[model samples]
Target: MVTRREWLLASGAVAAALALPARSAFAQPARTVKVAIGQKTIAPNLVNLLIGEGLGYNAAEGFKAQFMTVGGVSNAQVAIDRGDSDISTGVPSFALPILAKGEWGKAIHFYQYTYPYKWDVAVKPESTLTSYEELKGKNIGVPDFAETAFPVTKNVLRSLGLDPDRDVKWTAVGTGVAAGVALQRGAVDALAYYDTGFGQIEGAGIPFKMLPLPKNVPMVGGQFLMALRERIAKDRDLMVGYGRSVAKASVFLAASPRAGARAFLKMYPEAAPRGSSEEDAIKSVLLATARRIKLYDPPYAGAKIGSINPEEFRIEAQMNDMKISSFDAFLTNELIDEINSFDREEIKRQALAYA
Candidate 1:
């Protein structure tokens, strides 16, 4: 059964993208565009610039992409609203209510569905922790107090008949890396982190066990790609160009995982090893990154994965049962389709190269 959020988001996005007039407006030169990356370090979302920056795709299309750490999804939304950034990429579920507040108004449409590979609980490998019920009365650390991690953690706890508030003491440890360090140091009994952060801990030689979420619990709602709705409305070509850049990045990432991982490590040296060959470490990073990205692949061929579609409605229903307000806020593919058409040949070429 389709959930309300999927219907709402998809219908709204499609309607908005389709309603735009096709006539070209005034000519404008390339402008420096700023993007707000909510996360502290580089990840797949930066795949656009990681590839585009090196390949001059953004320049070829007409914009220089600038990135900065902007705290949580709310922070990125506020930044974009206050004109601190032009685009913001992060968790979509948390951003919806803010978007409904007209934060960026008609200037942005939330596009792109990132997978839910970012949230999980890890325990020290030495601990005999094999299940969620085993975590009762433990100290759990998460990046933020009110973020989705907390809720997901609560959901899991509830499913295991554990009250998170009463059974477990939760702390906000700031970054996943910090959480990993804390867990390794025995400061926290367990750390709630995502796939990449978990990769870091494993890479650091810390053996940890991931606690399985309850079978009935919902998969964490994924990240989103949001743009300035006004910019898209006023400058269709620029919007199309931005979309093309994203596609190019995704294709390159799929085609050249190792090279992509190398680029990723270059943007984030902290993600690489000190003595390992850059190529080897990058290949490791790329293999891991590719695995995570596959979770976001849309069901359709060459389709954007991980976004709200028919498959997520049931999850949304579960969220509603958990008291999450459900509405018609599904992610729409109209803009992506439009953008894909403009650069379909290039995308196909890159995909072929990667294949």
Candidate 2:
């Protein structure tokens, strides 16, 4: 297994790329908002986030954005709980368990950045595992045990009437080349991962036959931007403005995913693999992120982004065998209107006119 220390030593580019200078706007912000995410590499689903930074969406909203890279979601939550970071990124299902503890002190999942979970369970082309039932007693691979993929896989197994803990074994295969290599060498039977994980593997020439999400599963509300309740109450402008900036970036990226991929490439050139061509790098990112881009567009009838869908989380709670006292405790739609109050047509025009 690739250790975290080894991974960090090899990821100097990722660290260097994150040392971004603050974008300039007509008015400077009062303070820097530290936003944490549980990733080292630039995943496809984060195309909108990169675009948001690249295009000065945060600066336009009157704040400076600092992207912080941490070990995992659990760590990211700790960062927020300990007052180290203001906001963290993660999906709804995987977050349910951590949020249920109430130990995080009223952390609110205020922003819905991506939705209709573009997650998958898959097997190698030669594997005979075609259904969830077949997954019983089999080992599964995930990027990491701390990620949403593992819990989602466990709950998916539960939906199939199998004991997730006893009936299945899970292994952390790592991500990018490490994950693909694990699957290639038969380190695990099947992979329970998101679109970006699968796309990168396929991009490396390892194909998979995706197992369909069980009928009982509700794969909506992919990922969220979470912040502490006190922070939201005290820093309402920063919270809402950041969401608005992300909404604008999401709109622009969703309007033209290819353009978004191109923009990401230009913004973070180090994102590409050392020897990969620009065209190949674009294809790799697009392959991983294209399906997710569709969900970036506002799903609500009002054409607004970042609106929390509690019902989806409720179903997610049921599927994951997690208990929630109340959805409103951790979810909110109070800022949806302000978040979506942007001129989306202009974003589309900019997307279309990308040079």
Candidate 3:
């Protein structure tokens, strides 16, 4: 029979053992974060995120990525607000209204796909319209009046000394094929859309010339990685990992967009554009990736790949006619320092090695 002293000694030993730092047999597994993209259809920009997942970059950073596709930017924001997703991607234009209404939290821009604007006004190859001035009194087809493309195009026209509301007639035509068709049928004299739209038109055997926006205008549009303020506060490390993975993927894209496209196709073959063969899909992604790559060559005012410039946000707000009490209220660079911490040369090496 055990004595009281022996029982006391046993209890002490058990307590000491419990205090030891031993791995638990039933420890919880690492988490997988769900991320949503703004559009239901995957575009070339999303290919980088896919490449990062396929390459295990996110895993290396200590979490797994589960991508979720939503109907549009508003849906993506709703996913986060409803706690269905932890992160989402979209333009600040989409996020601004949400933030204004207190419907969501801040936007953290991780990808600077273009400066000033991503979309442009384009005319037929043989059309005599040579400049923004020529666009006056002409009908310009845009993706949607409510979308960023419309206001951005209007701003560009304003910078060109034309009143977008009065001098130019704006028509709502859908993107890609629809806008291309409008241009082809003379429904609109020019189409204001992204480079991808131009690619779509040219690939369909139509020739066009892009009307350049003035370089002196402030940077007005780009994409962003966003999360609710609560989520960002609680899961900063996860966001950092996400930023790092995407930064590495951007390097991979810059090195070889074709490889990025291949990885994307391997993961999501269904993302192939409508009516496109696998080869055509790859070509389309390559073309889109090439254009995005140019935006990073100088790296957005020499900042790191994922860094956001406060002044740029001010300009964007002005262009959108958004009134903000503070830029910090809507944007943050908290994760950028960590994302840019990796050795760029090493990132390039790994990117080149991605099969």
Candidate 4:
């Protein structure tokens, strides 16, 4: 016969054993985070996306991205509109016009990074055509007929004193591998390929060079990460957490360039060129990616999720030159407020190690 004290102690021990297993089970459950990819290729972005997945960052934040490359802003917008995808990447310039046409039921703009990420006029390195001026009368391959790529290409051409309408020819090819095929076959004199796509082509032993833009020319508009606004608001904490995560990631990329590159490659093995040291190539890529990252500033520099500035007044002015009056309508950073409230220092610290 046990004393009352011993009886109580035995009961407590039983409860503790039961609770231990429950805690372990809860910790082991895999969370799902559905994200949509705007394109189908593995390039600069795959590393970030992969990091979110491989490192369980997305799961920790309660997300599992269902990545599909619905190539072009118009197509990506339509996917979000139809409820087929939850998030997408699109030119800030084009998103406003699409939303202006009607109220979208889901998907909202949460954040943006003004990385003048490279999407250039690529040609075989052996070719003698050295200047943008030579693009006159050339057949330029575009990923989509209606998307940011063509507009950016045209903007660059005009910046070089070439009339996009009459000076150069445009062709619409599907993105990634398909666009590379067009360039390889000489079906197009120049192709507008993003840095990642360019890397893939280069990795395939195809000798191509991105036509360098004048240092001041903007090839890509400021880009934003868009999701269903209502959904984002409902899960405001998660959305803000993501913003904090990206801010952390951005700062990490800037401060620890080598570590960040390694992290990126680990997340997306396909991001690196075959037979090339992923470590070294990422360093080269980061050197270039860093400049573009600067364009977004604040949220990036301060590692604060929701910070934005009107300094893009210059970029807006550039859009105005394109006769884009609707520019201001879609550039909303209101949602970033939720992200700013969280502690992002650690995430950024971890992410920079990937650089």
* Maximum-TM-score candidate: 2
Q: In model 3, which range of ten residues has the least summed lDDT?
A: 16-25
Off by over 4 Å in 1: 1-29, 43-49, 96-109, 146-148, 158-162, 174-176, 266-277, 280-284, 287-290, 299-307, 310-332, 342-355
lDDT of 2 by residue, 1-355 (tens): 2232333353443333343433443354667788877665556667776567667677777777777767566555555655667887866654565556543356788888877666788888899888988998898998987677887677667767899889989899998767877877899998888877777777878876888667856554368888888888998888998998888888887777778888787767777767999898888888877677778755557645787778777877777656778776777788888787888899889888877
Q: Estimate every model's Cα lDDT from 0 to 1.
A: 0.57, 0.73, 0.67, 0.56
Each candidate's number of clashing pairs is 20, 2, 0, 28
Candidate 4 off by > 4 Å = 1-31, 41-43, 62-64, 99-107, 143-147, 172-185, 255-329, 337-355
Tens digit of lDDT per residue, candidate 3, span 215-304? 775576676777777777888888888888888877777777777877777666765777898889888777656666666433454577
Residue-by-residue lDDT tens digits, candidate 1, 223-304: 6666656655666666566656666666666666665665566546665666778766775575446455555455445555
In model 4, state the lDDT of residue 25. 11
Q: What is the TM-score of each candidate against the true structure?
A: 0.74, 0.87, 0.81, 0.69
- Candidate 3 global TM-score: 0.81
Instruction: Please report the TM-score between candidate 2 and the true structure.
Output: 0.87
By lDDT, the best candidate is: 2
